[model samples]
Target: MRRKGSPHLVVIASDPADAHFCNVELRKLKTGAIVGRHYILRSDVQTFVSMYRRDGFSPVEGGNND
Candidate 1:
């Protein structure tokens, strides 16, 4: 998604026990921090990913942390 210019993604997991696995191999992108924590339950990940996909990305929403 980031290759397509997506500024963020909210990764989700089906199990809380597996939740830590969600972020295990992933490297934290500075842009990723803007959306706050990326880990979430599998149930909600799709909703957020869909919303951002449909609406497109806005780097400004990440706030002026710079």
Candidate 2:
């Protein structure tokens, strides 16, 4: 998980040997515990992040450089 601001952003890709899948996890800032998790197709990552942004999560800059 990468620390952004109030929450930690974790984007986990499924096993390389299997079909491509992506899991996004939102973790609590204080305790580093998962607050929510979602399993989504790799193509939907942007849509998912957009929805979260609409719900008030700040965008993380620099893509996945962290």
Candidate 3:
């Protein structure tokens, strides 16, 4: 979820095969935040990406957790 004044974008993708566990990469849309810790099922990549692109990265729907 996002809060007021915390405007940002979160891009989630499947982790690299070298990773030790099932994980997902989460990073800011236009920022340089380091991304290598979040976790999500690899099977959900398509669902997440589709929602993200469809929403245009806005603070609604797939962008915001709320």
Candidate 4:
């Protein structure tokens, strides 16, 4: 998994539904975008948001406005 910081491991889902949920989470952290983290819809909202910060994500309040 991404948390383990390993290159060989990938978090595989059981089906398309699971993949979609994972995609929601993955897309939140895609390309290291900060503000993007807010789009993650899940029960562990706090935990999910904290992971980004714990892994070195910066201020997520402001972003490009052009």
Collision pairs in model 1: none
lDDT of 4 by residue, 1-66 (tens): 244442221122223454324222233234443222223334444465466558754332343210
TM-score, cand. 1: 0.35
**Which residue runs of candidate 4 sit more than 4 Å off their true CA positions?**
1-41, 62-66
TM-score of each: 0.35, 0.60, 0.38, 0.30
Q: On residues 1-66, what C-alpha lDDT tens digit does candidate 3 reach at each position?
A: 222344444545435674432443445545747454456565665566566557554334664232
**TM-score, prediction 3:** 0.38
Per-candidate alpha-carbon RMSD to the true structure: 9.5, 4.1, 8.0, 10.7
lDDT of 4: 0.35
Clashing pairs in 4: none
lDDT (Cα, 0-100) at 1 in candidate 2: 34
Candidate 1 C-alpha lDDT tens digits along 1-66: 332454454343344467433321122356444445455544565555566557663223453311
The ten-residue window of minimal lDDT in model 2 covers: 57-66
Which candidate ranks first by lDDT, i.e. highest? 2
Deviation in angstroms for 61 in model 4? 3.4
Model 3 weakest lDDT span, ten residues long: 1-10
lDDT rank, highest first? 2, 3, 1, 4
